[model samples]
Target: MNLSAAPAIEVQNLRRSYGDHVVLDDVSLTVPQASVYALLGPNGAGKTTLVSTLATLLHPDSGSARVAGHDVVREADAVRGAIGVTGQLSAVDDLLTGTENLRLMADLLHLPKAEGRRRASELLDRFGLADSADRTAATYSGGMTRKLDLAMTLVGGPSVIFLDEPSTGLDPRSRRELWDIVREIVADGTTILLTTQYLEEADQLADTVGVLDGGRIVAEGTPAELKRRVPGGHVRVGVADAVELDAATRVFPDAVRDDATLSARIPSADDLVSVRDVLGRLEDAGITSASVTVETPDLDEVFLSLTQPAAPSRTASTAKELS
Candidate 1:
């Protein structure tokens, strides 16, 4: 991603409400060019609402947003021209064949007949649906249907794409295949804004993650950076014998030892300095055969901690302080 370039999507204190109920409250975020930014939250956390506002489908009640360098409210047409949206529900027409679907989307974008046919053929091959291009959408499996839906979104060749729960119902293998496709899209310089309930998906795909709760972005950072903010991180050291275990325990007095596994679990901040210190102490104690591994809280833990009811409002500075 080009850090020096203007962000593909930028929001400043964007807010939206439905009568007395606020769906998005003072939400602000930036999605870097040609990168994936994942929005994670509970069922009513406004992930979809945020995406809708950015896609120019819903007008924000307050604040401002720019998508693909065009204001979502003022330059709605320009924003629409530069982006594509694949919503939670599949946009594929069940009665249409795979190739017909792409061609239909191409036609809607005003491409010429020959160009529409070319794009349809190319998209069918690119998404591995060429073999079933003639089959109706109803005949395709869950995975194939989802692939076709995404392919239709790309028919316009948009610079920024919004995927709202794109992998909601697929099996594990299908989900992984979709992840690979998303990676390929980003590699080709497309910026993506994705919303998902799957914590692992965000960890695997996002360059940055924003945890929305109570209609606010409570935390935002890279997957690794957010994981480091949660506590309970430790280093596990395995020893060959009881003698070595005893020596290692002496070196780390506060470590939790397990006789059954002959390992010592030493508390750590999950940082390089703490890991280097542990290894240096083991070497000094002549425990040369020890095997070490660092363990830190995963995204699940980070999500739960940051979205707690009493969790304070967090800025980038607050996130660093927690880390």
Candidate 2:
């Protein structure tokens, strides 16, 4: 990511409400150019509201947001021109052929007829949809349809894309394929703001993560940094035999011993310094028959620890409010 370049998206004390129900409260974040910023939050946590506000589909009650160097409210048209949005629901029209869909988007953007056909062909080929170009979207599989929807979003060559739960309902393999596409997009210098229910998605794609809860950003940092905030991170040293286990235990007396696996679990912060210290102590004791690994709490744990469970009523009402 280019630290010298101005941020692709910036928000300051952004707030939104529907009557007495506050959906987004004082949400603030920044997404750098050519990077992925993943927003993780539970249902009814205002993730969609925040994204809608930034995309200019909805207005903020207070605070401000700028996307692609344009204020979301005052310069809504310019912001819309510079960004593309892929909502949770597929935007593919079932009756249209894949090629037709791309051409339609091109028409909406007012591209020249010749250029529109050129872009349609390029996108179909780029997204591996050339063979299915004439196939109606109704015939496309879930994964293929998703690829096409994303492809249409790129027809205008948006500098920044908003992917709201892009991988939702996809199988594991399809989800991974989508992740690869996201990486490719970022590599080509397009900034992405991704909101996902899958915590693993954030861990894989995000350069920075912001955890929203109860209409506010509860935490923000890199995946590793957030994981470090949670407890239960430790290092496990595997030994060859019971004799080696005893020797290892002597080196790390505080470490928990597992006789069955002949490993010692040393509670540590799972940082580089701690790993080096563990290895150094083992070398000092001449315990050579050992394998070491560091284990830290995953994003799931970090998310669980930071956010509260949504009430059933709030979940229903929040959906209606956003709609």
Candidate 3:
């Protein structure tokens, strides 16, 4: 990707502290144009602090942040205009209808009366809140409330959006619904900076993921790259018959057989070339597989291993306060 194409967000030597408690330490990061960057850490790992600073909601003590090419501290207003923040808490006004809520946001953005109404209706439809447009937000489901909150954030058409644990407290279906919404939002060429404790969300939505621990980034890379860093990749293969399995067991001296399923789970790297090699070997032996699957290390594994905790008792809230 064009690294020089100007990032939607940029941070360097980012340091924040409260008294003697340091929340962030020389944290440097870049968010590419139109790409989704997931900032992940357990609760109190300073994920919220980093996000708030990037969104121009808070100032960093020593570090620098730029959103849409404007310095966050010196050009806070410019940064606010260039980016939209969907904070950890719902911004939706509970007394207003969905349409009314969006209109309120449009009005806050200084859109014309007619233009605000047009935009409000447009967002109501886009976020699946059209039918509920007239209904009070108090009666809306958690999923609906989140949709409306996100729609309200989009009224000004910001190029960058910061979502800080946007799916918190929702059921699985509601979380999935919000995930689809995020995908749609990014598909429209918007750059997203999402912070969440849910690893699955990051694994599913992020183009690049940065894992933070103890107020600093421990690792930053694509999902596959980060997975490759940990162990536990395997290949589970099903055979056509017991004879084929027996033959294959002999073919590969070190194979673990499952008597119930008539399959062998091979210990191997779960990479493309390795999979192709396994298939090629089966083809050479004139053997066919009833099924096959590749399993690798997931976020839980990666997080536990990477986030070794610089100091076991440090609080993420302390870090947040420093920011």
Q: What lDDT would each prediction earn against the true structure?
A: 0.87, 0.86, 0.82
The residue-by-residue lDDT of candidate 2 on 232-297, one tens digit each, is: 667899988988899999998878999999998887643433667778889899887588887888
Winner by lDDT between candidate 2 and candidate 1: 1
Per-prediction tally of clashes: 0, 0, 1
lDDT of 1 by residue, 1-323 (tens): 55449999999999899997777878899998999999998786788899999989899999999999999999999999999888674579989999989998998999999999999999899999999999999999999999999999999899999999989889999899999999999999999999998899999999999988777888788997787666666789999999999999999897899999999888764443266777889999999878898787888888877774434353333433332
- As for TM-score, the candidate ahead, 1 or 3, is 1
Candidate 2: minimum summed lDDT over ten consecutive residues — where?
Answer: 314-323
Model 3 Cα lDDT, one tens digit per residue, 1-323: 55448998999989887678777877889998889999988887788888888877778999798888889999999989988888584579999999888888888999999999999999888888899999999999988998888888899999999998988888999899888989998999899999888889999999999988777787888887777665565667788788888877776566688868988877663233266677778767877654667767888787777675556676555443323
Per-model TM-score versus the true fold? 0.84, 0.84, 0.80
Off by over 4 Å in 3: 1-4, 234-294, 309-323
Ten contiguous residues with the weakest lDDT in model 3:
314-323
> Which is the better candidate, 2 or 3, if ranked by TM-score?
2
